[model samples]
Target: MKNNLTKMMALDIYVSNLEEEKYSEITTELQPSSKKSVNLISWGIQDLFFEKELFNDLDTIKTFSKNFNWKDNVSTVIKENYYESLVLTDAEKKIIWVSNGFTKMTGYEKEFALNKTPRFLQGKETKETTKKRIQKKLQLGKPFKDVIINYRKDQSTYKCELHIIPLHNSSNSKITHFLALEKEAV
Candidate 1:
């Protein structure tokens, strides 16, 4: 219970950080109604009293995202932190989401990356073993972690510590999405 409460608090902080970054980017003042619609300030507070537990596990968060449209918030957090996040289209295995971290790290914007395969980030220096291991884990619908050489939009190479987690519809035991979390290996 205590752990869950801590996670809940952390999520609050996380949301605040994201809101700070998001609002910073907007120069115009929105009308009162528009602000209420665009931001979740009051909604977040109101929903804090819900009956559900508040643990921040990846799966639990994914479930909330699926049910309540928190998916945008999830990716926005990654974008705000300049941390790479990619969501594959479950079975089809195409890019469905790419965070701004792609832009900060690779110079590729969300508009250009969506609908493209993640392989676009790979180049000659990307090792065969790394690719194969990722593929194997993905095929097994299991979480995978590895360091891989990835290329930017400029085609420059950098080592990335990649963590790919299979997001499942736990009730049905079916993979609904994959989350690719990455950090600079430097």
Candidate 2:
């Protein structure tokens, strides 16, 4: 279902972040109403939400096209592959969902993570300016990605290649979800 929507939205990278307020701001600014039809925004948000969730589970992400209810909406040629990473969200953001990959990277299982903020991953080394930029963009409901430092359970720091995207219901053009992606480097 989500894969179909991604093709429709032509999304290169799909992500949801824990920081809903910040991601919301970016969406409103970058995706202008004059540029995109309401229908397009609705479809994109719905599809991206499903895709991010499916991507979290190894099985779901692998069998997405086959198991999803929206088989009719997706293309047959789409590929299924999961990227191992950590997914984090704020207590407020958990109402939406989190991905399985999140546990793999952060060593924190979903059961222990739900209702917690991903800011736990941020430490003294995390860049303040980059953090502010991400927060500001998400506050506006926009998509964002950048490299910044984040802490892990071991208190070890690594570069986080982060991606955050906003999901809108579009009935009122409201951003209901913020998707986040975090991969380690450096």
- State the lDDT of candidate 1 residue by residue for 8-118, as single tens digits: 444433333344567566525422344433444686653452222222224444555686432244434433332344444445668776544557777888788778888
- RMSD of each predicted structure: 15.8, 13.0
Candidate 1 lDDT score relative to the true structure: 0.60
What TM-score would you give candidate 1 relative to the actual structure? 0.56
Find the candidate with the highest TM-score and give its number: 1
- TM-score of each candidate structure, all chains considered together: 0.56, 0.53
> How many Å off is the CA of 6 in candidate 1?
31
Any runs in candidate 2 off by more than 4 Å, and if so which?
Answer: 1-82, 86-96
lDDT of 2 by residue, 1-186 (tens): 666553533332322433668666667544535764444558677567557655445343234324322222112211232234534343256622356666666766667666766676788998799788777777876666666787767787777666655544435556645546555543
